[model samples]
Target chain A: MGKLVYLYGIIPEGHDINELWDPEKSAIEGEDLPYVEDFGGLAAVVTKVSEDEFGETAMEENSNNTAWIQEKAFHHHEALLELQRHTTVLPMKFGTIFESVESLKQMIEEKEEHLQHTLQTLEGKEEWNVKAYINPKTFYERVAEANENVKAKREEIEQMSKGRQYLETKKLDKFIEEEMFKDQEKKAEEMYDRLAGYSEDSERKKNWKKDVTGREDEMALNSAFLVVSEDLESFLDQIREMEKEKEEDGWLIEATGPWPAYHFATMEE
Target chain B: MPIEQSTRSDSIVDVLELVLDKGVVIAGDIRVNIADVELLTIKIRLIVASVDKAKEIGMDWWESDPFLNSQAARKEVEDENRELKERLEKLENSMASDRTQIGEDNK
Candidate 1:
């Protein structure tokens, strides 16, 4: 049996190991290596990997197999969510694997105090994911209708000599790009101000990576909040109202959660 | 389900930000394999976010793209749908014919 490690989550102190842990499963069996299983209110599981078996070749065979990754990722999240329901856990992001259980134990022990504080602060507070998308049609239409300067520039270019017109159009393109960025920023600012009152902590996460949509330069204003469970309702109500209000502004405010604070929780090394 | 709306404060939360920007990053020898083909370890950054927002952004960008109006692509989608419908109808007819043949053979 080769070792396969699954990181569960970061937890606080005083978790009952006997109650929380299950005997090592055969599915994750490795050499009878000395297992180090200690959690700071957090428990991570690990099994050895037969380097020869899982070497680059095996993983390559499994890549592009969406169903395979999805299956494993879903189970991984399910396990983390299951732990989260009963304990204050900072769920690790999907696809986190380790070399061995002893390594996991050592890592946890080293970060025990930081993990504990994170758990305590996050206790009763769930992470909510919010994303805003600009409706391009509405945004463009609004820009065309409202910005006289833009219209004047376009008209001037249209009336110019052909050579000058080309130059003017180039200038106009630059102006449009700048205007687009300005609009994105303005919309982002407005949205942040609206939602900040509801969350104890909020941040703008920049998504520099390409996404499934294949759109380059998509603006993602990612943020997290520490909301008391009691206020969850009012928080939702406000978002619904804002959604209606910004329907024409090309703004999409989406929320997902009560999830573990995967973004906010950091291990103190 | 009642959608939990966010409150207005100076703080704005972007799902993309948290999932893409923030998180524990442990860099290792990264490798992505696909069908026995080892593509260079494409940096795999895990971004966890709300599915709805992602879809909205996708739809917005798609509709806004000038290329979406290309006749060839639009026709391709139409042809695909027509083919799918034809296949589905063919399957249904085949099943019906089999049932009728079986009934006649029974008699």
Candidate 2:
């Protein structure tokens, strides 16, 4: 049960980070609070974790414990976010722990060059997430309403006998679905490009499925944008306007964050 | 066709996806490959990656992804249920007619 260093993230050196702790602020499960470790030009935000807790076997076990991982991951996100507010941060993956400070420092020393570049690139920029959703039932219904073929088919079906009408109705549904697929592709691409315009760098994040989002609507696009802090409003403004324009078509746009550039927190240019 | 059981809440999915799946990787002395944490992907569930990756993972649901234009997933379920109902009706109606023919033959 020796102590290990769990790295939250890295930031530039020399900022007085004392404000980060509220001597009264509670720690996660009575664990030691995070502290800044000076690595010369760069600093690492870390906390003391127990070897028996954050060790590989523990991580493997905890990762499966839904309640355990959720709380820990949220705390990890919050920690990086706190640092991000004061200075640019290069967030580390969850459960990054070292047996000793020496090994952690060595790893930082190796990646310091890229880390610095990433910080520079991230300065004053916030990572914002934009998730777009479309309700298929609504989309289909609306598409059917405006679609000329659907209207023509409805009239033709009205003229058919009961048995014929059943088959015709099915054919109409199949046709609507085909048209909706094409529309989904086109609409998804257009929305992505439109939102990407507001950010300096954008990553196409995978849209989580129903099982994760806990919603019935399909997520067409889940994207992250590295938006300049100043232009955040414009990014959100676009989202609002887009939703307003398409709400009836069952389009839903969700904007979340000021997140700690997790997607762009890489050494790669 | 399937919604695997999940105890994960909605709020934590994005955070875990980013920090667990996307953040910078620095090899630590006592490393954890999150993949070993089976719950990693399951917790995040069906992150509709590119169509190619979706296929690679055998997540072919998107092909007929009953949901279109991102209505979340509800609309698709509703639409699918409706379609299924309609098809069932058509089948039942045809069966009824077949029953009538049997009645005549029985007579």
Candidate 3:
């Protein structure tokens, strides 16, 4: 059976990989060769996988296979979660398989300094993703009820003929959409600013659409926050506070994780 | 290694977001040169779109949100309910064997 090296992460030397994760719990069944390879001071957490499935051409062909992608994605995260429990993992993006151990180590040596610095920066902090969704039901009702323009249009529309009322109602929806966008921006920025205070670093991410979020409400804010373990309580407390405060204003704030710092571990020069 | 016992929730989208979209990009020998993050994201988006279409045909994807429209949402709930009932039946069977322990604990 041909084998390939699949890297899950890199970390500074000290850990015994054997004690870090259980082979019985390995993502892929009937695999026994997950190990740590020391390169200078840093160690690469890796495993031997079947070259047939993970080789360059095979991965490309399988990339669009939903069942395959789902399996890989789930297993990759599961392995990392175990690794993350034991150390500050400079996580390799999924599918970082190598033709051989030699090339993987060569890349590690070439980027050792940058990788080390990234590890230092990520040492104590974990990432939490925050998303704010606009609740259409209450938010639109409140905004429409409060706006002078909407109030005026309501009275004006009451006096209009049926044909004109239909047009005005369509116009009213367009007006509310504009109002919602402007309000969403202001509220999201304010909330992001407040959330940023409790974290080491923060970044704004692209908001997911309703189709992606699978929620009826629209996503207005997508952000990642790196919070130290000590600051996590306060960070979450702030989210809880915002979740309650923002609801009346049509926002639902959710904070998820204590994840390995996916955002902060980037080694881009 | 700071691997805690904490269980972080992630949908398939979140897994794709973290695993595919972000991380250290040491180029691999495999075709998955996720070095181009934007391209991979577009590819993932296409996959997600197909997943949505699958849901339309009554195919269920694991980690799907329960917030789909009424018909789909009801279907998701029904699926979950069936699974829960099966689990409840198994638990009831196990309880028959563990009745003495339960009686002792209840006291």
Candidate 4:
């Protein structure tokens, strides 16, 4: 048999544990409440899963099929959210399991000061995601219109550099790539400026090489805005208007939101 | 009531990142030992120039060979795994050689 996985999150002061979780539904709920530790600031939502059910072997076998991994991870993600409705929770990543309840308690004790500090920093803040995707066709057309010099150069190269067509094409491609990147950065900055007033701290999403979205160009800018809960509607409205303006020129601007502040939380190394 | 389709499937507010990145990083065993595997296997993400390119690649997979069948599929998976292992070994060896060279240079 395997050990239990303890969950950690922020919960309100004097929050009833029973109302937040049944614990009976956990895979190892019958064993114990797995020992809940108090930090005086927020309650840690802890639970355990059977070892055999989620061993390294399971991960190995499932890694080949991406769908299986997302399914399990998403389940864990939702479970964390179930705890969030009660309090402003700084959700842990999907696979944060510990060996024993005592070890988890020890970790909380060790990091209690830092954890409490993180929670305090995130008070009344919600995370919103803002993504900007380039509609290649529209963006390219805009680029052609914006850069007359490059366009004329391309024509000249096409007629004169027939022998070195590949080289000419390479030069033209480089010029186009640089301009596109510049515009993307400029647009992202403009959006950031518009939203900064509402956010405590904002961050760009990590650009890992993944094939989730149907775009090859590094997701132009994936940002997380930590906005005050009261400003949620206005923040969203601003995004809608910004998206419409960009959309007229073929930029796919999108925003999603009002979730627990995930990006604002940071570990003090 | 019929399920209402979401206009946008992916949400900007990634709750998982919040909890994982900002939440407490408890060093424990309830977590799987294979976190690296989790990163690699979470999706069959294929990056392409466009949606059409992605579809073409998807269709092309069927034309490649009989790798979809249970037997062939298992073999293909094993082959891919082995290739990754070999690539990792090669990278380590190169890194080791570079380190050794650096040590000599330090002398």
> Which candidate number has the best lDDT?
3
- Considering only chain B, report the TM-score of each candidate against the true chain B: 0.19, 0.22, 0.33, 0.24
Provide TM-scores for the models: 0.59, 0.71, 0.73, 0.66
Which is better, 1 or 2, measured by DockQ?
Answer: 2
Tens digits of per-residue lDDT for model 1, B11-90: 11122123211222341122323331111111111111222443444422222331222223233334334444544344
Order by lDDT, highest first: 3, 2, 4, 1
Residue-wise C-alpha lDDT for candidate 4, range B1-107, written one tens digit per residue: 11111112322123234434332233454434433421332122221112244234353332232122213333344434444454444433544677333223322
- Best candidate, DockQ-wise? 2
Backbone clashes counted, model 4: 11
Instruction: Give iRMSD, candidate 1.
Output: 14.7
Off by over 4 Å in 1: A13-42, A45-65, A148-177, A207-211, A214-222, B1-107
Residue B101 of model 2 has an lDDT of 37
Q: All models, DockQ values?
A: 0.08, 0.18, 0.17, 0.17
lDDT of 4 by residue, A1-269 (tens): 87556465555457677666645434222444533456565567766666555445654464344334444444455454555556667666555666666776677678778778777777777777777776666776787667666678787887875668778877787787677768867887888778877677888765333333424434566777888878777887787777777776666655665555556655444
For candidate 2, the docking band is incorrect
Candidate number that wins on DockQ, 1 or 4: 4
Q: What is the DockQ of candidate 3?
A: 0.17
lDDT of 2 by residue, A1-269 (tens): 68888888888897665765445434544558878899999988888888676777877676655446655776676666566666778887787788889998988888788888888988988887778888999999987888776788789899999999999898888988888777876787888899889889998866665534656788888888898999988988888888888898988887777777877887443
Ranking by DockQ: 2, 4, 3, 1
Q: What is the C-alpha RMSD of each candidate to the true structure, in Å?
A: 14.7, 14.0, 13.3, 9.8
Return the number of clashes found in candidate 3: 9
Least well predicted 10-residue stretch by lDDT in candidate 1 chain B: B36-45
Report the lDDT tens digits of candidate 1 across residue range A68-162.
43333333444444466667777664434455566666667676777767767888777676666666666666776666678877887888899
